[model samples]
Target: MAVQGTPEPFVEILMSTVVALVRRDGPDLSARQFGVFLTVYLGEGPHTVRGLAKELNVSKPAITRALDRLGVHDFTHRQVDPKDRRSILVQRTVKGAALLREIRAIMGEAAAASDEAAPGGATELRRQHA
Candidate 1:
């Protein structure tokens, strides 16, 4: 069953789980950090700090701070853009991908538990996203 114009059922749960994991495994990353991460992940091409800052409606310094924090967790890597030596690009590392996978697993477990406790749990999650 598909709900048109709605995000998938697990997305919100996965987001919640990932937030919890980030809180536990790394320095505190605000919802802004999560937003930046998700945007970069979904982007078709590489992401630059300035671009992300613009996308997230934050200052370059603020995005840099977030990137610095994420750096401590190996969640992102800063590299000089070859085309534009003055600019830096942030790329997600393998560790970051693995961590995201673990968080997704946690979310799946939570969704299952919620479903067990109350039916249509996944649908409820979708509604929350909506």
Candidate 2:
């Protein structure tokens, strides 16, 4: 069943990639958690709760909640920022890097599938699968 929304090419790729992610045997993260995970991994670091909240345009509570979930999976861990002594730094883990690789692979497969399924879909592929 197709979802009722604007049918953009990237949307199709996103749906396909998400479907693959759900079917796989691994941590199932919500959109928020995944966003936070990617942001911490993909972007430059020294990432604190405040930094993530600002970067993601979400509330600190929301970032904390997402981090709580990511922590359960060991994808990320919270550390007291030594320099600041007042902020919690959201640090990435080896497990989280593995997940990022998996996501890249899944997104690449989905993008290729999207291109094949719809010739000239022109779906911009995942950024080198990260």
lDDT of 1: 0.76
lDDT of each: 0.76, 0.87
Please list the residue runs of candidate 2 whose C-alpha ends up more than 4 Å from where it truly belongs after superposition: 1-7, 123-130
lDDT of model 2 at residue 89? 89
lDDT of 1 by residue, 73-95 (tens): 78889999999999999998887
Best by lDDT: 2
Clashing pairs in 2: none
Clashes of each: 0, 0
Estimate the overall C-alpha local distance difference test score of candidate 2.
0.87
TM-scores for the candidates: 0.73, 0.84
Model 2: per-residue lDDT, tens digit, 1-130?
5575555567878888899899999878989998999999999998999999999999999999999999999999999988888999888899999988988998888778788887766353344233
